[model samples]
Target: MVYTICYALIFLAEILISLFYFENKFERKASKKFLIISLPTAYTILYFARLFNITVVNMLAFFVCNFFLLRLCYKAKIKSAIFHCSILLVFNVTTEFVVMLFSAAILGTELLACLDNSVNLIFQSTISKLLYFSSMYILSKVSSNERRKESPATSLMLFLLPISSTLIIYAILYSLAEYELGQVFLTLLLIGIVVLLFSNIAVFWVYEFTLKTQSRNMELEYEKQKLKSAAEYYDLLNEQNENSKIVMHDIKRHLNAIKSIAKDKAVTEYIDDFIEDFSINKSVDYCNNPMANSIVNRYKSFCDKFGVKMNIDIRSADFSFMSEPDITALLDNLLENAVEAAQNTENGFIDFSAFVRKNKYLSIQLTNSVKNIVAVKNNRIASSKKSDAIHGTGLKSIKRVVKKYDGEINMKFNEDDMTFTSNIVFEIRR
Candidate 1:
């Protein structure tokens, strides 16, 4: 009965730890009732395995149970589910080995003798649980952000933690069981194991900090690129507008010259073509903000070149609430993604609309036809381009701007119609 109780507590602790890890990585789908039922079901399987003294089967059953539970209770891919389960299992095994080894050493007895006593079993399990929970708490404090992926170096180190812990435990146990190791040697081994454990935690914290720094730097670089692109687009539009003004100013003179040379059909046709090509009507001012207008018009030209139809409906409003750079980055990314998606379809088209609702909210929507819809993970649309690092930064930049303004953005795709849609809403703080 004591053994069963201890096993139940250990299993419950493992489940809670797994829950914390999964909650960080994936959305939860299971309810409280599901958890209540699943926990005992998992424990029962392990309990029966123990009854049959099937060590290998017990390990396999534990992993299988946790893997399926994670898959059923969370929105995670198979690879992610396996990775998480493996981490949990390694943590549990390492903690158990360390706690058992230390407990036996302190009790001055064989490891088997320690496990045979209910008092010792409870003590060992409690110590193991404390160590496991403490490590998890420190890890959470160290890596508070959602890490979409781990670096290869970090992954290798994480794998080594368990292996090293197991080896250390094995060496201590073998020394105690096979030979008479002195107190000094056992003490030193224990100290070394403790140091190794702390070092693993320190390394994890440092790697997480490094990853965070790298991520911030990438975002800063992306913002710089965004600003540069916006400035160039603004300048190009301004130059085109100036050229149109010059042509318009001399329109009367050109028309009169064309009339005079009407007898020569070639010259007259050439002048008429020039006027048509340099029509001032081609310049579009969609909003009160010049930068926003420039971004829209620039993408409009891109769509025209790609034989994609662009439909734009923008209202005049005071956009002084947003900085010029923020507005440019937001609009440029939206339009660029829309144009790129539309450029690939047979009947490619983009529908863009922006307006103020109730004088307090600015709502913008962009819908485009797509040949293939990209997958979204954690509410982020994954980049389909080969250069994920470069192509993915645009959306990340836009998200930063939206977050800065306490705005909301939604994205959706329709597989049946092969269309992608984005809606962004910002509260206008007057």
Candidate 2:
């Protein structure tokens, strides 16, 4: 009963650690009660097979069981699930080996003999479990704090660390298990384990820091590009506005000339239709702010090129609180994404609106037609484009602008209507 209880508790702790690491990734399709009762119990039974002391059985029970439970509880890609399981198994097994090695070196015994001593078994087990839990908790917290989209090569490189670590640790353990240890050799082994642990941790820290720094630099460059593009667009709009003014100034004279030259009925009707189209589809001045208007019109031209209908209702909205560059970045990224998504549909349309609500909030909504279901991973809208890093940066850029204003942005996809919606509400500062 004591052994059974100990094994059950170990399995429970391991399962809980797995859940904590994947809290964001999990989509709980099973009932809580069912998972609560079944996961640990199933793990304990499967792990009891380790008592047979077969290497294959141990590997299956440790790594395969973890992968299976995670898959059963969470919806994830196969590669992701396997990578997660490998990390957990590597940490757990390596920590245990390190603790056992230390215990044997101190007690002057063979590796297996350390486990036979009840006092040593308790001491090593407690210390190893503590080390595993602390390491996993800290790792999960650090990883959860930032969302980085790793390239395929980067992910594969990261995966290699744990795989190599696991194989190295196992090989070392097998080498030392059957031999009696000397004081000098034992000291070398202890140093090796410490180096292994610290090196792996340092690599993780450097990789995360580098990725974050790169992402920040990219976003800054993107902001600069937004400002530059906004200036160019506004300049173009100014030129067009000037030409339109010149055309409208002589409109009466031009109309009289057209009417007089058209002698045939078909030519007269064709000229009339051309005149009506110019009158109805003239450049739309979306808002009073020149920068904001340029951003909207720029996307409107793209929408026209791609056969997407662009709707705007922001004439009454006030955006004086935001800087020119901020306005450009925020609207440019949002509308660009909306137009790109809408362009692929048969009858694509984007509805964009912003208005003042309660005299203190500016509410904005952008809804666009989508041809395919939007996928969400790790609580983020997964990019459908081949270049996920680029797509992710676009989202991060929008989020950065929203954060600067201390606002809220929510995105949702309506499957029934086949549309994606982005809703943002910003507190009015002026």
**Cα TM-score of candidate 2:** 0.57
Question: Taking the tens digit of each residue's C-alpha lDDT, what string does model 2 give over 59-158?
Answer: 6677777777777766667898899889888898888898778767754678878556433353355456556755685577456645667676875576
Candidate 1 off by > 4 Å: 1-74, 77-195, 247-276, 279-281, 374-392
- Model 2 has an lDDT value of 0.70
CA displacement after TM-score superposition, residue 394 of candidate 1 (Å): 2.7
Clashes by residue pair, model 2: none
Cα RMSD (Å) per model? 8.0, 9.6
Alpha-carbon RMSD, candidate 1 = 8.0
Residue 411 in model 1: shift from native, Å? 2.3
Worst 10 residues of 1 by lDDT: 382-391
